[model samples]
Target: MVRRWQPPWRRWSVRNRLMAMTAIPLAYLFFTFLWYAYHSRLSEVREELAERGPLVAKVLADSSEFSVIARRHDDLKPTINGLLRTDPSIHRIDVLDAQRRELVAAAARAPGGTAELRYYEAPILKRLMWVAMLGPDGKPYQKDRPAASGVTVETIGYVRVTMSPSALLLKQTRRFYVELLVGSLGLLACVLLAWQLAKGLDASLQASMQALREADAEKRRLIGKVNTAVEDERKSIALEIHDELNATLIAVRLEGQRIADLSPEGEVRDKAQSIIKLALGLYNSGRSLVRRLRPEVLDMLGLEGAVEELVRHYDSARSGCRFDLQARGDFSRLEGDIAISAYRIVQEALSNIVKHARATQASLSLALEQGELRIRIADNGRGFDAALASAGIGLVGMRERVYALNGSIALETSPEAGTLISIAMPIR
Candidate 1:
């Protein structure tokens, strides 16, 4: 089964393309905006954590009730243990002195100095750096050594905190990118629809133009029929005049001859001879007129026979010039209309050859080869400008006939070179 095509308007359009272009940048900007917003939100969360973290540490450290009851305030012992045990927001917390001794921390029996320092330095210190930066009042806690020389001296103690916010921001940003990409794609689809609508309009206009051309061709065909009818009528009238009037005139001339033989040496005989001469010239002129109207040989014989006859007639009639006719391959196999058109072209060509081409020899060739019928009329005569002669009615008529048969005609001529008319008609 043949599938029906959708109408042009139904197909994709330029609006779609334009929308797609805008959507790409819009998506990028949207994603960037969301990324910045998510980052700002996370940074805000982390910053709040930084400021409030120290306060939480201080409260745990200085709380007198907890220090007395838990026995944890002597060093910030209760602060570190309470923060780590309760709040999940805090990963780990450590309280250290200026001497790098662990003042308080969970998971150890006594105060940790060197061994605790080694443990915190590797994992705990690295984690805390992201969650907070030390304030001016907070002491510089040496991560590796308890008392390395050349370090800042005017310090007391510090509380360290560690948290995870990078993973949190990444999860939120991924959601925003997905949403932004989807929205951009939706916008692109809308634009595509609009563009397709506009393209449909252009396609319809082209269809209308094609219809108009077809209508014009039909009109031309009708016009051609009318023209052929008028030509047929004129030819019929010319033939009637030649046959009817000329036959009667010939009969009268014969009767005049009989009377002139009986009365020789009289004015009657002289007048009779003059009348006969006049009648003969009139008959000759009538014959020429009939031939000009249409060659009878074209009707009596087919194209090939008529063309050969015309060549022979021209050879005798115009003895000053030589006309050669050659045929190769099957000329008889050509379509009737094509053959007739070819013959007319040759007739007009020879006429021009005699009239303008001041040459002594002209040749006509007709052949068929490789599915194309070829006709060539060439002369060894002074050639004229091809461009100028193209405007001539004879050449134009030849072109029209050739065009009707889906064939082509070309004139090959230069000033010194002879004129050559070549026609190629596709036969298969």
Candidate 2:
């Protein structure tokens, strides 16, 4: 699965991916932190009010007794109003009698729609005959007496207080808004940072890839130039050996024959004839050697005829082997190097067939299509595995030469089957 996806991603340059990889996590981490912090802090603010609501209600209950028993509705305001002024969290307060009815309720400020309310109740218990007493400092104190000692006790009322949580949460909302702002800005910065980092990384890698491609092209060209030079030198050496050395040996043989005809029919004439024969042998051997190095017919008969001559020579030397050549288009008009490379490829392929194919017949085809020179050589022989046979120096050389010409070569073969070598070279 990974291999299947690799090629498509390669189409998007390296930089874009790197930036996305870098920025996404940072923005995600920041936003997650912001989300967690906002809810957690907001919960804390709400909890503070939830815990404090009951405390504020209980405090109001403890002090509401005098206002409730006196039935002074106007007097209940002062007690609640003082506490409201001290703590802003309690937005409203109410003192009710024991009947669960409204008595005196006071609000320092109206609770908004979103504000929460809390209720607390405290009971007022009746006392004995001496209900209250005064201390030495003239402060009122509660005194309790038994009801059984001719004392009557009566129930008074209850105090109910109401509280609001809006005032306590107002300040926390401001801090939460600030956190949201910072988190948004931080997320933007992370995206920008990742984009820049990806661009830088991609640019460097692309530059390196281009440099490597150019270097590889240069190496191929250099190798091609060297191969051309070597071939030229071989041609020059072959022509010199075939022309100069062959001529000298032939001239010497003619001179020896002439000397033998003028001599008497004795040991001297026989020795002269032997000399002529040896010189003639040397001349023939040197000519053969030159032809093997560089086929002279290539310059005379052109590419096609030269190839046929090679095939004919091979057929003569090896019995039970016939080479059939089929051609389309004019090979003689092809570029010199292209033609030579094609001939050499065919030569090498035929050599492999003779040395290894173990077949009686081989077929070679040359065709021109869409400005490309196509050559196919096949042999009906006991062929070896193409994979294993490719390790041979002959095939390697053929492949290298074709590569230098910017051409392509392919081989098809299996054990006990025939072999086929297909090549294509642009004919320009």
Q: What lDDT does each candidate get?
A: 0.66, 0.77
Clashing pairs in 2: 98-158
- In candidate 1, which residue pairs clash? 13-195, 13-196, 15-191, 15-195, 16-191, 16-192
Can you tell me which runs of candidate 2 are displaced by over 4 Å?
A: 1-209
User: Clash number for model 2?
Assistant: 1
User: In candidate 2, residue 149 scores what lDDT?
Assistant: 30
**Number of clashes found in candidate 1:** 6
- TM-score of each model, paired residue for residue: 0.48, 0.53
**In model 1, which runs have C-alpha deviations exceeding 4 angstroms?**
1-205, 208-216, 219-227, 317-321, 329-337, 368-373, 426-428
Top candidate, metric TM-score: 2
Per-residue C-alpha lDDT of model 1 across residues 152-195, encoded as one tens digit per residue = 22334445554434333455567757766776676567557656
lDDT per residue for candidate 2 within 240-303, as digits (tens), equals: 8878988888888988999899999999899999999899889888888887677788878878
